[model samples]
Structure formats: C-alpha cells, structure tokens
Target: MGTDVQVLYFGILREMYVQAREEHFSLASGATVADLVERIGERHPPFVPIRERIRIAVNEEFAASGHVLSSGDTVALIPPIAGGSDRYCVVTDEPLRIDPLVDAVAGPGQGAVVAFVGTVRDENEGHEVTELRYEAYSAMALRALNSVIDRCEQSARGARVAVSHRIGELQVGDAAVVLAASAPHRAEAFAAARMCIELLKQEVPIWKRETSPDGAEWLGMRP
Candidate 1:
C-alpha cells in the first residue's frame, strides 16, 4: 500500500524543471513530508542543495516536515516569497505607478503624503544584473500586505496606507514597489510609510530572483 500524492510547484521553483507544473508521486504508506522531499530530490538533483530552505505545504496549509502524508493529498513546494490586495494593497504584474498609490491614501485633512518606490538596479552583490524576476503567491501575499497596512493605520492615528508590488520579470530601472501613506502631520505620515515598507519586505511572501550574465538564482533560500 502507498500514498498517491499530487505535487505543485510555484514561484521560482517553476523555472527549475522542464516538466509540467504539477506532478504525481507515490510514497510508501505513513510517509512524511521529508519522505516526499527525499523522493523529489532523487529526480531533481537541484532541489537537494536548497532543500533546507524550502517549505512544504500540505493541502494549502503550511505543514511540518515530519507531518504524515495521506493518500490523495495535494502538496506544494513553496520557496521563500518576496510578500500581499485590493486598491490599498495590490499585487500585480503590470508596471507600478506611484501617483495612483499616493492618491489612494491621500485625502482631505491630511497634511502630508509620503511615497516610496523600489526600482530594479543594474548591480547587486557585485554582479552585473540584466533582469530580475519577482514571484509571489498572490492571494496569500495580498492578505499579508493588508495586514501590514492595517497595523500601520492603527499605530499612526489618522494615517492611511497603501502599497503595490509588481510581479513577473522586470528590467533595470523598472519600478518594483510603490508605497504611500497620508496623515494629519508630516511626522505621522513618515512613520506610517516606514512601517509599511519594513513590514512589506520582511513578512511578504514575494521572492526575488536576480539574473546576471552568469545565470539566475532565487534569493533568500540559502542553506
């Protein structure tokens, strides 16, 4: 007897293999997430090196490596994401514009509005980069961003916050993120804007993949 499982690949993992996005696997009964990973490692040697950084999600929920797998279970291989929704918190592949984001949070009674933009640079880690790819788990990522905005709003009285992150491939000089905040005073607006950017980078599931003349690699998954 064995457990039949479906495996899914997302973000930077999709570029690792030439096969379809989803694959089926057979694991011995009572297998754990680690067991399933070992099986995957056998076929895809590239996974072995970064195996420790990869997280396993069983049935759409994060699971421990030791969790037991059941027959017909669906598993996803999640790489560290770059991280979150609506007009206030957006996750899009289209070009990011600062004006719209600024407007979203700007309104009457607000004396100061601050905006931040993160652009693709030509150099990183002493390497000459040509392109960068951002991957994300959209729905979940959006929720995370919303949480950030909610917290910023609560911390800064009368402050409004909005953020947008761009997904997919981007060239040098492309805008990757647009964040804005408005408040009754300049100090409040600045504080809210800082909180949003810091939280967005740390908690968001958006992952960055840098491409240079040598090759491309997904960051934040180091062993």
Candidate 2:
C-alpha cells in the first residue's frame, strides 16, 4: 500500500489553522518528518512554531525530527504545558460540581482536606492586568486533565479531588481554577493537591492570555 502523510497542529498554531488537525498533503514516494514540516510551513507560515518545538511521532511512538514518515502515519503536534491552578472548585468552559470531588476523596480514616483556588490576579509581573483569557484545544485539554487525575488517584491516600477552570474573558479576581483533595491525613491531601496542580501545569493543553496595562499577550509556560 502507498504511504499516507498527515499534518498535525497545536497551540497558537491551531488558532491560525482554526482547526485541531489537518488531513491534506501526502508524501511523494518518500518523505521525512522534516520534509513534511517544511512543506507545511511553506504553505502555512504559522506552522513555524510547530517546526520549532513540536514532537514528531509515527503512529504513536515518538520519533526524531529527521525520522522518515510512512503512509497512514498519525503525526501529533504537542505543545509545551502551562500549569493549572491548585484549587478546588475548578472551572473550565463549563461549571463543575465541587461536592462530588470532595465526596470522592473523603473517608472516615482520612482526617484533613486541603484545597487550592486560583484567581485571576489584577496584576502580573509589573503591569495591571485588566482581564485574563484562557483558550484550549478542548478535546486534548480534557484528555490531558483526566490523565493527570487518574495518576493522582493512584498515589493519593484516599484523596478526593475537584477542579474548575474558566475560559473566555475573565476579570481580575475571577475564579480561574480550583482544586481540592482530601486524604486520611492532612499531609497526604496537601501533597496530592500540590502534585495534581503541578502535573496539570506541566501536561494540560490549556493556555492563558493576559490583558495588561500596555496590551494583551499570550502567556507562556514557565521553564
């Protein structure tokens, strides 16, 4: 069978493409991952970022930039992650129920519940932030979040968790996110909650935009 070529896009690049994935473009007999990126970027300059930091995969396994791509290969553009807040009562595009997460973690044996809520601050770095905006590739974002939650569930000692995040234009002090975890012991809850937030920030596909005194700009993940 002939090889098929696919183009994957993510992050701000998606905003430019206005779609999650692209299905056009095929290898001419033979093509490498780098060749595909060059063709795409030549056709779509915004794909430059994808060329810079994207991870290439054949099928599902990670490949190098120079890897040869076969037909029917599924390529994914993975973006750097920004941490989600450490707070319970988290909100995303829609509202979330905190009580359920609380119930999931509570136990007669567990003693303490630790929760964190992240609010959009009016100020960032030095300027006054008028509002904040959050955007995501919803399907991927939710999947990544669920993955983090599942991992935490295995490690937390009877921990229950709740998270909520806000999307669209959000004013300062508005709730951007919430996380809560309960464990048999306070220490475990605290640790679990912290880990959850850290993992989310590092893995989730959510990005933030900040409107400040000067203007608006997208926020990047801290190294």
Candidate number achieving the greatest lDDT relative to the actual structure: 1
Off by over 4 Å in 1: 1-87
**Candidate 2 positional error at 4, Å:** 51
- Give candidate 2's total backbone clashes: 23
The digit string of per-residue lDDT tens for model 1 on 68-139 reads 999999887754333211235667666777876676678888999999999999998788999999988876
Candidate 2's C-alpha runs over 4 A off are 1-91, 94-100, 221-223
> What is candidate 1's local distance difference test score?
0.81
Worst 10 residues of 2 by lDDT: 82-91
Residue 92's lDDT within candidate 2 is 42
lDDT of each: 0.81, 0.65
What are the per-residue Cα lDDT tens digits for candidate 2 across 1-223? 4457775554334544435445567666567778877877777776665456555545545567778777778775543333322222222443333444464456687798776777888788887999888887765765576667767766865766655555677887776777777778888888888988999888887789998878888888436
